[model samples]
Target: MSSNIQIHDIVITEQLSDRSYRNRNADLEKQAFQQLAKQSSYGAQAILNALCDLTLSLCDADSSGVSLLQVVDGEDGFTWNAMAGSMASYVGGRAPRHHSPCGYCLERGAAQLYSYPERFFEWMRLVGKPIVEGMVIPLYGKDKNAIGTIWMISHRDGHQFDRYDLQIISIFANHASAALRMQELY
Candidate 1:
């Protein structure tokens, strides 16, 4: 474990409003599905990349990516599998599992909302983009264990995400889970 890491037990996952999200755009959802279906043939990586792009467009996020839990340097960590928007250059980056927002999302077993995550995650500072608000949805594999997370970030401070944004990301997370499971099989 890196000695410089800090574990901030901040509970960023709030009880988001349970009210049915009314702002969903049916045409956009349909388009995202179509895009994902088309990418499936290109393999999991393609599907993940398409998912990131779709997330950026659908949620109007400054950056979006998938973080998959895996062993890195003999320790458990999360790898940025795919990315889009401003953070796309970090597609292959890695961070310790226990110290990241994705780990907290997996632990809560729900979508998490982070405000100024770099304050808690020191590694995020290295990305060079300050995350104002971020949303993370847990991704599960075939055994139903959390295998990773899908996250979106708003670099603009005061950019708030409502239930509609949460719903959209949750839907995409479901697709991401299926893609990961298929990836496990192959």
Candidate 2:
């Protein structure tokens, strides 16, 4: 199937609510996985980009990004590898594994929501960016080890992330983890 066709299917599936949405989202996610599994290296990257876009769209957020953690010569850090939406300034940047919010999630090996200013003050101060509602979910490898984080940022005027948001994001993060591992192996 073409990328456009896949995206159209995803968009349509996302319009449903309640159990229907969950069911459709799972189906669409499965389709996405199948597509990724068959892709070449370049195609895999395209799918990863599309997945990032789909994640931001589904979350109804202004920005979304992914960070891959690496243990560098005894130090650790994450590098933003793929991203979509309005927070272009932070994309392609690198952060120390000890200092970043993404790092915090990686260390804890869990999903973290930062909807309050205090939760991400250090990130905002270090990057000189504004604090907004956002979340970070750990991206685990096939070994189930925390290897990265998938994150999204809401605009100042956008609705804050709720429990449902966290749940959906966690699902997307699972997909992201698999994709990142694929990229590493291929």
Q: For every candidate structure, what is the RMSD over all alpha carbons to the true structure, in angstroms?
A: 3.3, 11.2
The digit string of per-residue lDDT tens for model 1 on 53-96 reads 99888888999999989987799999899999999988899978
Q: In model 1, which runs have C-alpha deviations exceeding 4 angstroms?
A: 1-12, 18-22
If scored against the real structure, what TM-score would every candidate get? Answer: 0.88, 0.69
For model 2, the superposed segments whose C-alpha errors exceed 4 Å read 1-44, 71-75, 117-120, 126-129, 183-186
RMSD of 2: 11.2
* Candidate number of the best lDDT: 1
List the global CA lDDT of all models: 0.82, 0.62
TM-score of structure candidate 1:
0.88
Clashes of 2: 0
- Judged by whole-model lDDT over C-alpha atoms, candidate 1 comes out at 0.82
Residue-level lDDT for 143 in candidate 2: 74
